[model samples]
Target: MKKVKKGRQEVFEEGKLEVKLEMIPQLLAFGLSIEQIAQGLGLDEQVVRQAAQPKS
Candidate 1:
């Protein structure tokens, strides 16, 4: 049987709002809207959009 692999889990400091910045892409992949992610992250939508862009 084959096993499924998942990304390693990350831990954030308790009582802090900070999350892994790298989660932007994963959240985008999960179909979350830019606005939703931005609002949830307390960041401007433009910053979220920019971060969501693919790197050349």
Candidate 2:
């Protein structure tokens, strides 16, 4: 049996982060500022900004 890291287990098993990642762009399209989105989503501004980046 392989032991997965605790942090990885929590991040993958719980989908909150994934949901937040999905919401960033949707919030932006709805005219929310980066700071507003971060506050509403309880994420760091940098994290929200990264999610809003172009996917090229």
Q: Rate the local accuracy (lDDT) of all candidates.
A: 0.70, 0.90
Model 1 TM-score is: 0.61
All candidates: TM-score: 0.61, 0.76
Task: Write candidate 1's Cα lDDT for 1-56 as tens digits.
Answer: 12222222222332233443467899999999998898888778887888788999
Q: Worst 10-residue stretch by lDDT in candidate 2?
A: 1-10
Using lDDT, give the best candidate's number: 2
Model 2 C-alpha lDDT per residue in residues 1-56, reported as the tens digit of each score: 24568777787856888998899998999999999999998999999999999999
Candidate 1 lDDT trough over 10 residues, lowest sum:
1-10
Looking at model 2, the pairs that clash are none
Tell how far residue 25 is off in model 2, in angstroms.
0.6
- Best candidate (score: TM-score): 2
Model 1 residue runs over 4 Å out of place are 1-20
